[model samples]
Target: MDPHRLLIFREVARTESIAAAARRLGWTQPAVSQHLRRLERQAGLPLVVRHSRGIRLTEAGATLLRHADAIATRLHAAEDDMAALADLAAGTVRLAAFPSACATLVPTAMTNLARHRPGLEIRMTQCEPPAATTLVTSGEADLAVLFSHDSRLPDHGPDLQLIPLTDDPVRLVVPTGHPAATAAAPLTCLASTPWIAGCPSCATHLAHTCEAAGFSPDVQHSTDDYVVVQNLVARGLGVALLPQLALDAYHHPDVRALPLATTERALYLLCHREALQIPAVAETVRALQQAATAHRPQTPPAT
Candidate 1:
């Protein structure tokens, strides 16, 4: 099948209108229609039906849409792999990471990559944890750095692969002057205190932790900005539940982070299963694992 025709058909099916697909693809409407017709002829089936306002996929079209998406994803990965090989001394590795992970883990990972694989280019974007998996699965990023609480894991699509990087404990952050800051007690003791939260996924993790402690936390503020969240806590607005990573990277004089009695979160490296086979990706993964191993905390000898 013609790749161009399959691409056009995929776009038309996604938009449910030839005009919209043409606009998206930067092609004239007639051109899009012709591509769709050729695709249908190659498949020997009626792929689409005209609707009063747009178009609807026939049964055969729906089946082919799934295959088209997979094919497009693989083709893009192949191109990226080829480009990386062509310029082994200099090629980009696109990455998506959560805000806290970006600040704490990614800096070290990138530094390691630079020292060891200086030829490998690194590009990173801060994304909400929920969206990180999608970015990798859809081929928008070559790799994703993501985190999951002990109670909940982020869902990457089945075709995506995960590699464990670090298992860090979650901590509670409060204003230094707050009574809870000095107390050596379980997180449940602060349930009634107003809490600042990260994005929805982080909030869910906090909620789960609180539930295990036998009460739902009173969330007073929520934001995707890690710096803003720390600033809010510093101003005594409320406390927050966060990973040790945030404490390590964004510590403030007014904010104190306490280890939670129970709960640890896992940070992971995610990529499409198909992309993992690429040589550049494999080398990058090795660099990341080495970075993680070197940075992992060592247990002190018991007295």
Candidate 2:
């Protein structure tokens, strides 16, 4: 099968709609259909099946798409490598960072990379830590900045390589006017206060932290936005457990962040073991380490 046809088929598989693929590729729908037909004839199997809403990949289609993704990643890496040889500073680093990390760490990392290698292109996407790991594993991102609570690090997928970047501590945030703000006791003192949390995965980390403190948090509001969580806490809606990075990124006067007596979250730079050989990806890993080190949280003042 022609590589171009395979690429088209892959796009269709990803978008799950021939028309969406055509729009993404800037090709007409008929051209996309024609390309898929050519690929199907060459493969001697129907790669995709249509349904009322859209389309789904057949079993063979799923397997072929996975292979196609790997092939495309390798081809792109080859092009990037050749370009880097002629101009060491010029190449793109596709990064996926969780939303909180993206807010501060990525911008700082990009700034550092620009100063050192101005020609390097840095692209970033905001995704949760687990999804970011998946992006790197699937070759969709050259590198991903992922975070896990202390308990979760050893459980990272075996296929991925993890490089320690920072050990960020989780902090308790309370409205400035709340009684908990002036309390010097452990985090368990606020156990009865309502909590604002993120998704299930993030909430699980918070739950573990609370469980260790001898109580479970009452989650009154749950959302994926750290900023919104901060806002809700600022308004006296509920207390929240947040990472120091997120707290640093958001400095609302209405909320005060207190250090947790115990608990630290580790942030890692992740990549497929195979992708580390690429100079751009290697440089990105270095940049992330530098940024994380430079931006680490200082010990909070005695409260």
Candidate 3:
């Protein structure tokens, strides 16, 4: 089968409209239609049916789409592998990382990559784990630096390879004069305290941790930015549970960061199994590992 024709068919199957597929592929509608006709001839089956609303795939088209998807994946893998073999000296390494990782680990890693692999271009996008995972899986990103609460990573296929880099402990931020400011206790100590959650995911984690400790947190505020969360706590707005990475990146002086020994998010450098073979991917992984080592919280900061 012609890979180009298969690609056009896949796009049409995805959009369910030849014109929409042509627009997405930057090809004229006639060109896309021609390719689909040729593909149907090769397969000796009616692949699509036109109706007033749009096109619907025949059973043959659906079956062929599955094969086309696999073929595209393999072809992309081949390109990655060939790039790996061709040059360690120059290539773009697309990276997706969460905001906190972007503020800390990613910058350090990029610095090291700059010093060590000067010819490599590092393109970064700040994304939460869910979006980052999709980008890596779809080959939009070469790799992603992501974090999960214990083993609570999002569901994905075996194609994703997770490499453990570090564990960022969750910490409690209290106003400077709050009781917990100078004391270390299980998160239950703040059970009755009003809370500020970093993100919806962090809020869920906080609620779960508190529930596990016998109560639910009263999350009075929410924001995805840790710096904002810390600022709110510093001003005595409310206490919060935050990851050590965010604290490392930016902590307000008026807030005391107390260790929550029982809670932590594990950081992983994630890549597609095929991407691991790319030399730039391997190089960036090493750089990220070095940064993680330096930033990994070895001990709880003094209260």
- Tens digits of lDDT, candidate 1, 27-71: 999999988998899999999999888999999999999999998
Cα lDDT, all candidates: 0.79, 0.83, 0.85
Of 1 and 3, the candidate ranking higher by lDDT:
3
- Sort by TM-score, best first: what order? 3, 2, 1
What are the per-model numbers of colliding residue pairs?
A: 0, 0, 0
Assess every candidate by TM-score.
Answer: 0.66, 0.69, 0.70
lDDT of the structure predicted as candidate 2:
0.83
Which regions of candidate 1 deviate over 4 angstroms? 1-88, 184-186, 299-303
Can you tell me which runs of candidate 3 are displaced by over 4 Å?
1-87, 183-186
Instruction: Mark the regions of model 2 whose C-alpha exceeds 4 Å error after superposition.
Output: 1-83, 154-156, 301-303
Q: For residue 265, what is the lDDT in candidate 1?
A: 83
**Model 2, range 61-146, lDDT digits (tens) per residue?**
99999989988999899988787644647888899998878888899989988998888888999988778877777789888888
How much is the lDDT of residue 30 in candidate 3? Answer: 93
Every candidate's CA RMSD: 16.2, 16.7, 15.4
